[model samples]
Structure formats: structure tokens, C-alpha cells
Target chain A: MCVLAEEGYTGTADVKAFLAEHHGLALSDVDGHLYHHLNEEAIRHLFRVSSSLDSMVLGEPQILGQVKDAYGYASEFKSIGAVLDKFFSKAFSVAKRVRTETKVASSAVSISYAGVELARKIFGDLKDKTVMLIGAGEMCELAARHLLNAGVKGIMVTNRTYERAVKLAEEFDGTAIRFEEMVSHLKTADIVISSTGSPHFILKRDDVEEVIRIRRNRPMFFVDMAVPRDIDPDINDIDNVYVYDIDDLNNVIETNLEERQKEAGRAEEIVVTEVAAFRRWLDAQQVTPTIVSLRRKFDEIREAEVAKAMSMLGTDDPKTRKVVEALASSILNKVLHAPVTALKNDGNGRDPMELVAVVRELFDLTDGGKDCE
Target chain B: MQTLLLKSTTATYLVGALLYLYFIVTLKERGARLGRMFLLIGVVMHLFGFGMRFAEAGHTPITNLFESLSFFALVIVGAFLATELRYNLRVLGAFVAPLAFLFSLLSAFQKSELQSLNPALNSSWLPVHVIVLFIAYAFFAVQFAAGIMYLMQERQLKGKHLGAIFKRLPSLDVLDDINYRCLTIGFPLLTIGIITGSVWAQDAWGTYWSWDPKETASLATWLVYAALLHGRLTVGWRGRKAAIVAIVGFLLVVFTFLGINLLPAGKHTYASIAR
Candidate 1:
């Protein structure tokens, strides 16, 4: 069977077509099979791959984690059977090994830093600069620490949860402000890092414009690290009010290729090695049923011949019958030896099922033949 | 000790940048591989250069603006490498390699004249503060890449330019998630950097919160991201608008890092390092 990875597949139709053309399996057929085979353990594995379980950042280690989880889950559920199970399990183990051995998850490179760095570029020294942290989540805490480290004068953490805000603020040695006073703090803050999980803009354009007025022409750097984003997009149009969301940081991140190239070679080698091992295990699996069938055929032939011989020597000694039985078994083994070796040595070519059928026909094994070979 | 290695490394970076640009235009996977190889070579050279500089300086190479900027770029590259390994985002190399090369070039042009540390910058906390701050900046650089990708991906989705490159890029959701995660991690580092720098300033200069230009610009950048994070969580601000905000914030960081340093009136003058 041809093995094709679904990675480069783009459109839904393309994926479906490729699976059908290459694997002779329709998308719908695999869809039900895939989800049905998924259990709690599989879900947990998926989560691990997605990095939903990591302490610093979820989904950061997701791709490898997902691949490993899929393999493990497939094996445990017996969805892949013995052959596929071995193949998938090996892949998962390799991925896990790479993750452990490499320094892939060391740095927390991100957009929030981009926001802070941009502020630094605008302002020469962060010392004595006032910062307003709009959200009290982990994102805010991180941004707050960055600003504080840059010599920002003070930090004010505001969150929906008063206790969370208080906790974050205390940890950073900053003040905890009520969510209601967010705008008041905005008016004074020279920099703001927002990562609230709200569904709407917390800082409206008008509200930010008013704050800009209060702060005079002094620039206010706004870093919207939230997904839905915390500040109004229109706020970006406001003069001296610089607003940046996630995309702006990409420019800054693109400059690190030189450093990353050093490790890519190692990672690529690991992936290739694992893929080869998985392929071998998959190939070896095809011969198992053939071996079983061949042994059974030999057993059936031996029993039939022994029965015939027993009748011929019925009036003779019992010792003669025992000799005849041993002789029949030895003859059956000699007959099957060459075919068994051929089946084992088929490499990537021979079909095990075809060999099983041939052995059955050769022995003339009838229905309900018991314990052959 | 290894001056030749340093020069060769910088040369390698220049070559890598050209190859990466070719990969971008050609869209060949092999081009990407070649670019990556060049970049790897450059990194080795860059590291060697740093070693030589360190030996000559007799301390951490973060005492002056020139050294600080050089180290800053190095940290950015290091952070980028880690992210690439985790995410398998080789496409980003096309953009990042040039920036690294430019920073190194700038460093190369910088006057290497050794000067004694000023009374205020002589404290033990100086190195720690600078290192933390630079590392934080490196993380922000990653966020910038994610942010840019988010915007490009969004445009592709909207404009129907879902070509091979577009397909190769991560999903908008993934980029957004990564951007937020990076910010979450870097923000704390920045906070600590700011706090420690403040303490150092107080000990040496007799005051903190002087509202110097550098201080003002840093605060502004901090406020912007704080708003972005808060706005995202509490208000559900996202997509194009959020991305635009992130982009603008990064520009401000550049201004603060470069523009404020050039300003003549600020107490945080770039004069010490510019010489």
C-alpha cells in the first residue's frame, strides 16, 4: 500500500481526492473510523501534542505531541492492529525523544516582547515609565515583568477578577487597580499591555483618544496581544497612539533564522529515521497470517494421510502405527519448508494472503480441518 | 582569539540572506534547505565572534550601547532558533535572517573603542538588567513574526490568495495563539528587567521614575501591549485590528530603541555608545 502524508494537502476536496486516489479510502470512511477509534486517552494525547498541557505555553509543542498522541492512541485501541500499532508507536517514541533531547521549548519568543521592544525603541530608557497592564492573566504578568525589567517606573494591573489582579500585582510589586478604573489608568500610562479574554474592545477609540489628549503629544504604545484583541483597531489611526496586534511582531521574529538553522538539520534527521523504522514494521506485518495458514495446512495433510495409513495397518502392531504417524508429520514439514522460507523472504513484494490460498489448495484442506500442522 | 571566524560568520550571514531571498522568490523546498544551511554556518561564526569580543572585553559584552545592541541581536537569534525548533517554522527564516545580518552589520560598523563604565552603569545589576531586557526584546521579535503572519494569513483567507506558501503558513488561529503565548512569556521578563533597572538607577543615580525619553518610550510600549492583552481577554478584540495594533506597537519599540537614542535632549543619550 502507498503511504502518503496529508500535510501538503490543502483544500478539503483535495484532501478527500488524494486519500481516495492514493489509499483507496474515502474521507468519509476514514472520518468515522478516526473519531470512533479516538478515546479519552487519545484526547489526552492530542492535548499533550497541542501543548495544552505545557506550563509556559499551550500548543507550542503541539505538532509532535499530536503525532505521538495519535500513534499511541491508535496502538492502545487496537485500531491499527499489531502491524500498524508497532509502526505508529515507534513514530511517537521518536517524536518524544526529539522533544526531550532538543532545546526546542527554551525561549518564550512572542509578540508581547515585540510591543515592549517597540516601546523601548520609541523611549530610550524604560526607567520611570508608567505601565498599565490591562489584563491580569499570565500574558499580562509576562508583559508586566518585561516592562518592569526595562526600568519602567510603576505597573498597574487591572483585571475582571479583583483577587487575580491583586495577586498579579503583588507578585510584580505593582499596584492592583479595579477594572472600573481602567480608563483612569489608561489616561496616565505611557505603555499598556492588554490580554484580556473579552469578546469586545475594552479600550474604545474615543476612550483612547481622550487618554491621548490627557497625556499630551507623548506617545503611548499599545500592545494588543489578545486574540480578539483588547483595544479598538481604530485606535491605531489615532496620532501618537501606536497600537500593535500580533502580526506586527512577525517582522521582529523573522530575523532569527540564522540561529534556528543550526537545529533544523538535527530535527529533520530524527524525522527521517523514525519514518524508515515505521515503514519496516509495517512491511513485516504482511507475512504473519501467511505463516499461520501455512502451518495449519501442513497439519491437515498429516492428519488425512495418517488416517489412511492406519486403516492399511489396522491388523498389524500398534508400534507400526506410531512409526507411520511420525513419518507422515516429517513428510508434511519437508513439503512446507521451501514455501515458508519464501513467504518470510518476500521483502516488499510478495502478498501473504496469496501464499495462504496457495498452501490451502495444495493440501486440499477441507472445511472444519482441525489443528493442521 | 577568533577574529577570522567572526568575519567569516558575518560573511556567511550575508550569503544566507541572499539564498533565503532566492528561496522566497523561487518557492523551492531545496532553496529553503540551502538557506538554512547558510544560516547555520553564520550562527557558528557569529558565536565565534562573540567569544573573541568577550575575551577582549574581559566581562560580559553588554557594557556599552554597541555591545548591548550586538548582544541584543544575538539574543533575538537565539530566541528565534528555539521557536523554530518547537514550531518547525522554517518559512520565517526568510525574514529573520536579513534582520540578524543587518544588526550584525551595524555592530561591525560600531566603534570598538573600549571605555570605562560610567559611575551609574558600573553596578553589578547593570549586566543582569541588560541581559534580561535584551532577552525580553528577543521574545517580542518572535511575537512580531507571528503577528505579521497572522495578518498575511488573514489577508490570504480574505483575498483568496491561498497559494502554496499561504497553505504552508500556520493557521490564523495558531499564529494568534502563538503571539499571545509569546507575549505572556516575554512580558514578565520585561517587567523584571524594568524593575531591576529601576533599582539600579535608584542606587546609582539617586532616583527612579525620572521620565527620561527612554523611560517614556518603554512605558508607552508596555502600555500598548498591556492594553492589547487586556482588550483581548476581557473584550474579545481580535483579527485584523488586533494584528494592526501589534505591528504598531513593535514600531514604537524600534523608535524607542533607535529614535530616542538619537534625540539630543534626553538624559538617556545615545552619545556614550555612538562614539
Candidate 2:
């Protein structure tokens, strides 16, 4: 749930114990196992996480950017090596492919979208309606943006701190009103979107009742996106007044989640295929050390054999010894060619580890292979 | 050779239209890219066809129904390509390419045997007048497509059940902006075309004012756009209302261009299929 900073570990228990010591918290032990992965499993996990398959708000786009930033920071500090480099880069690509090839992230998944959708139901078009936000909360700013994109005529912002309200209003290119004067300007808004931190209802029935009297009987929609709610629930009983809270907006978000879940199935398949491709590349890469050792062993044997034969034949002439060395290496190269090609190209998709084991036994290749370990 | 050129243009347009239609239907990004490529190719072929016809006839080639329809389709695809570049709106091509294909198809099937110009049609002003009107029709075609997309996007937004078409289409504001922009450009060109035709009529027929069906219908089209523009400026009438007017005006353009020829009375009858 929280970002781990500068924390690298080779095992799960170390991470758990570190968290417990740093934060004085303990994870429940009733579960079968706390999820953990290393190496390829870790790569697949990061790929799914970056692609938003593991996000609660399925198909949301922010997690990929966050993941990229994390990987970027880790690489900047020289903490990541070849394994993580390939894994994170491929994760970014898989995320991009899922984003473009599937309709996974097309639908907006926020409480803000629900507010805009509800306002649209009342006005049919937001092009002529005015929306007033009552707070400087993140929810208020986001809902205001959605309403603006839907073509609201104007926006009004009001906060207890007038300066903050003015700042938020400036961001939306909207007019800011003083908190005390919000009731007077309430009649100007056709859709009132409020997400304030107030403990009690900001727009009471009496205030709206008076505003309704000032204007004729035009309908007004109220979206209270705050926890503990900003608008009075009884306002729904008012004529032509609709009020929806966070839970009501959640229903809309849940429907959007279901839609994205259908698309996520295709996205997961893309991630899986990319993982398999990356695995093949990694397996081929693993064969490189054994190939290097095999060539080293063959060269050493050729040099030793040529020296022994030159003295045994009593041939000190450089031309005669040169012919012998060339003849010896040609047979070695021809023997190495087929096995090298099989390992490099992976033509039949044979198990690369088994092939490596065979080469190790056949040629007694061990020097450069041990260097790799 | 000219007939073959026209046929080839039609074939290219057919491919372009199918690609664009499939792009819209499937929301395929590659289809849009390839569709744009084919549409531009079709435009190039159409321009070559027009150039050949002009060379063959020794004049601007829109003297009859067959030639005029081909010219109209050419200007439409040409103007459509220019707008697509300006806006970077591939979806607009999806809505307009089919009209180009249909017109090109009709042009190919029509009697393409070149006719000696009826003496009444020999005025130099006739070519300029027809070309300007068709260019105006080209912008109107853009307006029609933009309006349809505006309504469709608006419906999708309001209905709250967006599908592939909604996602492929542009924003409602962009679509509305395109509609208004096309109207502003099309209306004045149409007015000038109408004025030029009246002058040509006066010189040829000895009268500047004739309430013939083509004249009347074009006048009606002009008035609709003019009123819409005026409302946009003075009363701020736009969006769905402006889109509807633009659509209605496009219908009037279609009618004045060809439907009036279907009627019994008009001096323009010899310029059409009845001859």
C-alpha cells in the first residue's frame, strides 16, 4: 500500500521483519502465505502491476507512470542490473501494448466521472449549466474538470479559506466566491458539486429552499463527493433537487470496473505472451557462458596438441607447424558449429538448461561457466 | 483513356471508403492510417482524371451531369484531405470518404461519352460558377459529416452508454467547432457562387432573377447557413441547434446540385441527363 524506499532484499522474511521493525506493525499469519516472487516470477508480477491488472481500479493509467518513476529512480542510483533492466523495460512495453491494443483504459474510473454523468442526466447537455465546487479537496478539483470537459458554461469555487478557493478557481478558469456569500450565489449554479472537509452538511435544506424561491422551479443536481457528505440527504426530497453522495457515485465506478475487467482478460494474455518471449531471450542469454567456456577449452587443447606434434615430427620449419595448427582448429570449429547454432537460435525450442548440461558433460566445459556463477 | 482514368479513380475511392468504414466499425488504428493513405491516393488519381478530361475537352470539364458529379467528388476528397491535415482528425475522413466513393461510382457508371457543349452552356462564367459552387459543396460536405458526428457524440454522451463509435469520434466541442468553422467558410463561398450564377443568368438569359428550382433551392441553402451564422454571432446559438441547421443545409445542397434536375421545369435541364 505504501512505497518502500531504498529497501532491497533477497528474501520475503527480511522485508517483513524490516517492515515490522521500521513501522512497528505485523502482518496476519492466518493466511496460507504472504505473496512474494523472485526473478522471473518477480518480472511477471511487475509487468501485471504496471499494466494495471493488479490495480483495484482496474485499467487505471496512473500506476504505470508511478511504476516507471520507481524503476527510473532505482536505475538512476545504479541499484538495478541486467535482469531488472530488461524486466522493467519490457514491463513498460507490455503496459503500452495493453493500453493501446485493448479498450482497458478507455472508460473514466473516478467518483468525478459519476458526478459528471449525473449532471448530464439532469441538463442533457452541460454546455449551458454552471457548476459550483464548495471545497479545495482533490475530489472537488477533479469533478470540476470533468464537468468543464463536458462543456459546462461556467464554474464557481468557494472554500473556507478564500485564497485556496481562488487558487483552485484560477486553475479551472472559474470565478471564486467567498464562503460566507455561497448561499447568495447558489442560485447561479444549475449543478452544485461539493467535496468539502466540513463535518456537517454545507448546503442545508433551508439555504437551498431560499435559493429555490429566488429562482423559478428549475431543477438542480448536487454531487457531494466528500466522505461524511457535504450536502443534506433530505435535499433529495426537495422538488427538482437531486443529491448524490460518495456511495452513490461508487455504484457508477463499480460498473466501470466491471467493464474494464472484461477488457483486462485480453490485456493479461498480452502480458503472458510478452513474458514468454522475454523468457526465451533470457534462456538464450544463459547459454552464453557455457558457449564461451567450450570455445576456451577447445583452443587450449589445439595449442597443446600442435606444440607436442611439432616437436614429435622434428619439424622446426614454421610452414609445416602452421599447417598442423590450422588443420587441428578446422576440425574443432566444425564440431562446435551445430551445437553453437542450436543454442544461439533455439531452432526447436529445446530445453536450454538440458542443452547446457549436455555441453558441460561432453566438452567438460567449466571454467567460464563457473565465472558466470 | 479518360474513361479508364475515371474508372480507376472510382476503384481507389472504393478501397478508401471500405478502409475508412472498417476503421470506424472496428476502431482499428491501422485502418485509419491506411484509410487516409488510400483516400489521398484516390484524390491524386481523381485530380489526374480531371486534368485529362480538361485536356480532352479543351475547357473546364463540368458541362453536364457526368462531368459535374466527378468534379464535385474530386473537390470533396481534395478539400477533405486538406482539413484532415489541418485538424489531425482521422475520424472525419471516416464520415466523408464514403460520399466521395459513391459520387465517383455514380460518375463512372453515367454516360461518359463526351458531348458537344450545348451552345447555352458555352459561357466561360459557367465553369467558374460551377467550380465555385462545387467547392462550396465540398465545405458543406465537411459540415454535414461534422454535424452527424456532433449529434452522434452528443447522443453517446447523453445516453451514458458509449460504444466503439463514441470512442473513435472526437469530442463534442471539437465536432461543434468543426461544424461552425465549415459553415463560416461555406456560406460566403456559396453566396458568391449564387451571385455569379445570377450574373451569368442575366448575360445568357437576359434576366438576373429567376426563381428556378436550382436557384431557389440554392438560395434556401444560402439562407439557412446565413441565419445559422447570424444566430451564432448574435445569440450564441450553436452545438446541437447549429449542427441540425448545417445538416439541413447539406440536404439543400444535395437537392440543388442534382434533385432539381429531376423536376419538370428549369432552364438547367439541358445541363443534366434529360438531354
Candidate with the greatest lDDT versus the true structure: 2
Scanning candidate 2 chain B in windows of ten residues, the lowest lDDT window is B157-166
| All models, RMSD in angstroms | 18.2, 8.4
lDDT of 2 by residue, A1-373 (tens): 3233211323466666666667665555412345666656766788899999998878888899999888888889876655456567888888999999987887767888877765654456678889888887777788888888889999999999999989988999999999999989999988888878889888899988777656544557788878788899888766556677777677656767777889988998998887777766555446787788778888999999999999999979999988998899899999989988887764245555556656676876545323123
Please, what are the lDDT tens digits per residue for candidate 2 over residues B84-163? 88888888888898888788777766788777878887889987788888998999998899899877876654444555
| lDDT by residue for model 1 (B176-260), tens | 6667776777778878888887888788778887998888898898888788788767655665556677777777777777778
Residue A63 in model 1: shift from native, Å? 30
lDDT of 1: 0.64
For every model shown, the clashing-pair count is 130, 0
Fraction of native contacts in model 2? 0.00
Interface RMSD of 2: 8.8
In candidate 2, stretches whose alpha carbon ends up further than 4 angstroms from where it belongs are A1-33, A38-40, A69-79, A113-131, A135-138, A141-155, A159-175, A178-255, A284-373
Every candidate's DockQ is: 0.02, 0.14
